[model samples]
Target: MIKRKKIYIEALRILAIFLVLFQHVPAFDYYLQDTSHVMGHLFFTLIAKINVPLFLMISGSLLLNREEGYREIFRKRMIKIILAILIFNFLVYLAENQFVFDLQDYCLGVFENGIDRSYWYLYSYLGFLVMMPLLHRIAQKMTKNDFILILFIHFVFSTIEPLLQWFVPTYLGQSFEFTWAFRIPFSTIKEIFYPLMGYYIDRKIHIESIHKKTLAGLGCLSLLGILISMFFTIWIGNQEGFSDEYLELFDYVSALSAFILIKSFFVHYEAVIPAWISQKIVLLGSVTYGVYLWDPFFRKLFFDGFDQFMIPWVGGFFSSVLWCICSFLVCGILVQFLKRIPKVKSLF
Candidate 1:
């Protein structure tokens, strides 16, 4: 296993995240909503898609070798996520000033109701947290033959999941009625297999011999995946033309595949960029979670009346980026403060 902390890997994580962030920029819809040309930022979806699964894959590779038992693993993983959910949801309630009725409604359907909006990611990730230990053990057991079987298990589950939800109908994701984030019980259980395959692949595949060539191959696959997904997204948008609700599901899957390919490229690459720019990117990327959470508020703060501001596109764009950075910094400070709070220290 690659034991040392690779700064480039960390950089890839942050970069993938920002692709998600920039893709969320409202200006893309503003510019490309009805045009022949797609916004550059729209490609962010293709790039950003890999962000989460890559994260999980990385987690699997890094954590599977740990010596901790199941109970210790569970405590280590779940406590912080569960606490984060509780604290963040409680804060959301306070901001909204209404009772969550013991999180009954929020748990039942946050996406559908749009009650506590940001908690969807929290719920889905928490679901992952709960299942990690079992997944790790499974990874340790599989032989060469078992690899294909494990992958088959993942493929079958992924294929049937969406169909079953629409036709047979069951509780697909977290208990939240609003959005499953598509991580249902079966899929969540099935999720155990992918990380192992990722871990398996990483361990068996030596990039040192053909780092440059493999990186090229991964880059091509990543490109192919993104182009196909972008076509699907753009096609649906133009013809079937956007089911804001359902299309996002396609987008998410596409993003995941692309992310994995990109991750492989970085992992296999020997030549990294300059330390100064890499460091800056990593720093910005470090604040990405906070940035994702707070970007909307920052947009509201700075860009609410951007067009009316007497300045040109340069001013407006800078304002948007600047406000995003400011928001990340502010949230970073808040996260730091939260870490200091005795009761809340564990949540981070």
Candidate 2:
């Protein structure tokens, strides 16, 4: 029997896609450069950085529980990703080239420079899928203590070290360098950690058992930590010229905490969500991948159009939000439509 859809997971998926759309909204970029609404834009951008990790975590939560063999994973998961890259990259190439298809240019774009910058996650995800079998094995064999140890190592290296490197010089007025001898590549660590945490949370921990007050406190603290880190990073950058170092919010402690808190909230209170709303969430969640692929194209369109008809009062964050909402709905609808077509459904 087909397993029933998890409403909370679907809710998180929808939220992730929305965050993705919000992050790519050009208004954030405009305001960041303008520096008038820097904090507001930066705050939202940092929060949105959780989008990719949340997606990865959700993947782990769903995928690690399965006992699918390598053949099934290849046939079902890997093939679809490969097809999406080929087909969507081609579409992106066509759009970029004004529908004048050039095989040479397309090949170069795919093999050399990426066709679209936004689809970087797809490539990363393809890598993750390649390693999923090993991840699954580890997930199956590992105890809770093992999972916790791995997460701790990831937290120390991925999150804590960076925070210290950023925080120490600015606040403490001292040089601090802490390097690990057995350094794992960050991309590999990220691919492993987020999903592993997701599996751990989903399988080992019971969200419903956690008190609501505790979760609330964590959520608040996480948000505060994220804002403070971002504020200081931006402030220091202004003082010492901008660097992408700690300002890159993904895999940060606060962001991960926020992700877990949000996940917990959804999972814990999932029963109270209205059935109608739950259904809607599932439907939208189903199309998030397609929406993600299609969003950048529409993002460009809406960004340009919004700029052309720019309203003075709504020029900043509000306009960016409007652009994201419009793009999300349009892309979601487009994806839903595409899903109905026989030839193109699978690729989408």
Candidate 3:
């Protein structure tokens, strides 16, 4: 039987891809030191920060409640994921070779370093898949209070500790061994935290009964979180001669809140949608993984290609928007082509 799709998951996937694109806006990186473009940097950073968490949450919502055995999960779910990672890593090696000319070095680097930093999500997710059986085992045994308490600890370590470490040296004059202890836990917890939260919410919370104002309130808080992120970025950038990387732990609050709001929004509104638009939306959503894998390549292409045409005419912000749209269209078309290939379709 063909299983019915959840509207919210579809919506979340589409949202995540766009946010990922926003994060990659070339101007954000190139113009980070430009005071005039601070607003642009902050806007993109806020949306980009949410992309990975929301993507993981969507995966958790879809996969955590499944009845399949470990072997089946590996065979059915993870095989494709692993394949995609390998394929994309090879693609990245080829892309990077254009400048370095060292085929041997690039081959070794692909396994050690990411094909691109964006591919970090793929490896993180692969690890998450391996750990899911154990995670679900723990989740199944936990009481509501236990779940909340664990999440509290995760937040403290993942978000709070990192934020504190950034400012702690200025006050304390040096880093401590205890800081590393806290930091080490985040390396383990970071990948699974948002997904586990999504799973818990999907398996436990009832989103339909929640007041709509709750969602609205969370949406507002998300906006506030972005503004706070902006100020913090500027403040920290100035602190170290505009050389320090902008810190954005504040994204956790808004990312989690936005996930809940999006979930609730779809649950309440999805039922009234027309079939035509719904199918179209779901179709677009289906190609997101491919879009993510190919986007970096096309981003480089269009960003460079449009430099002469769009950048000169429209400026950086609008040129970036055009680049993003063109990348999306190209990726969508490419993914659809990949889907038709018998053996390769499964990788996407």
What would the TM-scores of all predictions be? 0.66, 0.88, 0.87
Error of 1 at 17 (Å): 3.2
TM-score-better candidate, 2 vs 3: 2
Clashes in each model (backbone N, CA, C under 3 Å)?
12, 0, 0
What does the lDDT read for residue 176 in candidate 1? 23
Q: Model 2 off-target regions past 4 Å?
A: 1-5, 164-181, 185-188, 249-255, 266-268, 311-313
Candidate 2 per-residue lDDT over residues 258-332, each given as its tens digit = 556766766656677777776787788888898888876655444666855755757656777887777778888
lDDT of 3 by residue, 1-348 (tens): 112345667778888888787677765454465667777666775677778888887777777776567798799888887777767766766665554456576566667756677777888888878877876776566568865776677666655666677667868888743345344332236567777777777778888787878878878877886776667667777665553243455566677787778777667666676777678777888899999999876554445767667877887766776776777778989999999999888878
Every model: Cα RMSD to truth: 7.5, 3.0, 3.1
User: Candidate 1 lDDT, tens digit per residue, 176-233?
Assistant: 2224454434234524544665566556545445455655665665566556546656
Task: Tell me how far the alpha carbon of residue 322 in candidate 1 is from the true structure, in angstroms, after superposition.
Answer: 6.1
Model 1 RMSD, rounded to 1 decimal: 7.5
Top-lDDT structure, candidate number: 2
Score residue 328 of candidate 3 by CA lDDT. Answer: 78
**lDDT accuracy of residue 7 in candidate 3:** 61
